[model samples]
Target: MHVPDGFIDAPISAATGVVAAGAIAVSLRGARRELDERTAPLAGLVAAFIFAVQMLNFPVAAGTSGHLLGGALAAILVGPYTGVLCVSVVLLMQGILFADGGLTALGVNITDMAITTTVVAYAVFRGLVKILPRTRRSITAASFTAALLSVPAAALVFTLLYALGGTTDVSLGKVATAMIGVHVLIGIGEAAITALTVGAVIAVRPDLVYGARGLEQRLKLRVNGELVDAQAPLEPATPRTSRRKLWIGGLVASLLLAGFVSFYASSNPDGLEKVAADQGIDQKAKEHASADSPLADYGVRDVDDARLSGGLAGVIGVGVTVVAGSGVFWAVRKRRSTSQAA
Candidate 1:
């Protein structure tokens, strides 16, 4: 959920800001081990992909719709630390450029959507993979289960946050019930998308999928009573410029998704927003600060055609998000390179 301003009190929001800042700082350091030459560029792509897919909201209930949260998908594709950064990047871009989420509540959104979802989903994924058969199917299954649980976990976290710092005197129990119930339906959609996307990537390039890296044994075949791993023929180390091609390809895909495909997304309020409105949790919500921005509400300013305005805004959002995300990841990669050299 976007969590607009005035939903949470100032003191609690400030406290969450500090907690989010610290968590991001820790994730940056941890991500150094996760983002190497191959994964660093992919991390940025994961962010942009998340940004793109989130634009396509699917109907969940009568009035509620759901979209990809991207924590599990990103974690399965990249790594947990990098996944946090990915969702954070999308949230930041939506806040600053699209005015989808509130600036003042940025920390709240990041904590609930980025940090909580990634942490819970990754933990569940690791646990399930440990017990299940080490097959690609098992990995897909684990991804599905982890993604399914992550959405409700995030809803619970928001419930707790609202209990502590809610601006209105709504019943905490009722809020929790409604939030969890609606988000569970949303979680199903999240699970399907995460599994399908992870499955597609694993099919094409399992080497690029962080969660499937050590699980390659599942793809091995038995030869003369001995197991032989079916690893892709190792490529001689190539120039770093090759990675730029991948980055460019990912950015182009994100642009296509947002620029054209997003026009077909359902025009209904998402799960959280619908639930809040139905249950009166949104009664205390305030307007977004950047509501007056040209690209506010995912439309270009003075554009009469709804399709053209939304399409242009979506394309600009993808462009801005990819640039911002790639810059952060490239800096992290460079720092890692420098440290290794030293």
Candidate 2:
């Protein structure tokens, strides 16, 4: 939810910082098992796409809007550990480059948004897939249910954090009720987005969807009166749409969404911002440290044309996020290869 500075006290914020760091450390190791040559690049693109979709905030209530949180979408498309890294990269870029989320509260945002959402979404997804049919439809259904629950789970986590280190003396019960109540509406949007995106990827390249993998049964044949797995062709036929083409298409979609479509996003405050303002959570909120950055507030400095400035900022954000995310994933993949060789 992009918690801003001064919303949580120094001690609690620092504690969350430690928690975030530890989780990242563990995820880095875990990602090695998840990322290989085929999926590593796709993982980076997933991060960039999440960054783009997050810009298009949809109206949720009278004054509140919501955006794709990306945890369930990423976990379903990639894997849980890499999903955490994907969201973390977006948060890092937004904090340092866009001045959107608070630098001081980075840990709080990661813990609530990145860690909690990914863990909960992936867990729910796994549970549903285990019980449901192992079809693409079932995977999509699980993604929808997982995403729907993840948003409120994140809201509940934020409520707990605020209860412990809230700067204001607001009623805890009221805050929880408002936060959970509104986020449930937001969760519906999240569910739709996650399901549609996952279903699209599964349709095109089910091989690339981590959650859909292992669902395809090998063709069985009767040979010499015995049922046996069909022998794979020595030279596997090329996929109609190559991974390179998929990556290019995804990047183009991200560019379109962020560069132009975001202009139509509801201008109302998001769920977090609306709740904070209504609950007096922002009474002690401090200004973002990067507020003066050229790209602050998702606009280029001195770029008078609102459309052009925002478009440039969005494009730059997508470009930077892709490069950074790819770099991280590539390095992780390299480490995996080196260790295997050893």
Candidate 3:
């Protein structure tokens, strides 16, 4: 849920801005441990994919809709720190380029959507993995549970933030209940998508899936009445395909999700917007600074056909987000390389 401008007072907003900035700085350092030769490029794709899928708002309740918050998916595919950066990058792109969220409330959105979800989901996922069986099914189940809980956690955090500096005089209890209720429904969709995506990646390349790493335990096989440990799948196969193809495939999927599939997304207010209106939280919401931009609101300027305009905008968004996110990751990777060289 993107926090629009004037939702929280200036002081609290500035505080959250500082918190978000610090978290990003720390995550950058942590991501170095996560990003290497193979996963570095995937990090960028993670951001692009998140941006693309978020455009396709699925129906949640009767009139409300929900989109991919993407923290759990990114954390499961890449790493938690990198996941935070991925979602943060998407939020930044949406705010600056598409005018989807407000610039003033950028920190709030990042804090609520990126930081909260990643932390909570990753913690839950890792804990479940430790307790459950070391199989792909377990990983997928954990991913689903983590994603499910993460949405409500984010909603609760957002409610707390709003209570601290809410612009309107709304009942805190009502806001909390509505936010949690709607987001729970949204969470179900989030879990399914996250589980499916993680399962897909794990099926093809378990090594590339960050959460699946180190889970390559040998299976026992009975040979001549003796228990023998069989070879795990982590080893590179003889006909091992280059990771470049997978990266390219991911990029193509991202493009299709944003450029084409998004056309069919539900055209209704998301859970946050619906609750904000219902609870009067959006009473003081201000217009986004980029509202007058040519490509504002996910539509290309001067494009007559609704489909074409949105498609073009989505394509452009994916391109920009991938480029920007790749630049950040590549720079981080380079810094690591230089340090190791020294």
Best by TM-score: 3
TM-score of 3: 0.96
Report how far off residue 136 is in candidate 3 (Å): 0.9
Which ten residues in a row are the worst by lDDT in model 3? Answer: 233-242
TM-score each candidate: 0.92, 0.94, 0.96
Candidate 2 residues 247-311, lDDT tens each? 99999999999999998899999998999999899999999999999999999999999999988
Pick out the ten consecutive residues of candidate 1 with the lowest summed lDDT. Answer: 232-241
lDDT of 1 by residue, 145-173 (tens): 99999999999999999999988888888
Per-candidate alpha-carbon RMSD to the true structure: 3.2, 2.7, 1.8
Error of 3 at 79 (Å): 0.5
lDDT for position 32 in model 2: 98
Q: Point out where model 3 deviates above 4 Å.
A: 221-241
Residue 71, model 2, lDDT: 91
List clashing residue pairs in candidate 2. none
**Residue pairs with backbone overlap in model 1:** none
Q: What does candidate 3's lDDT look like per residue over 174-285, in tens digits?
A: 9999999999999999999999999887777778899988876568999999999886764345424457887899899999989999999999999999999888899999
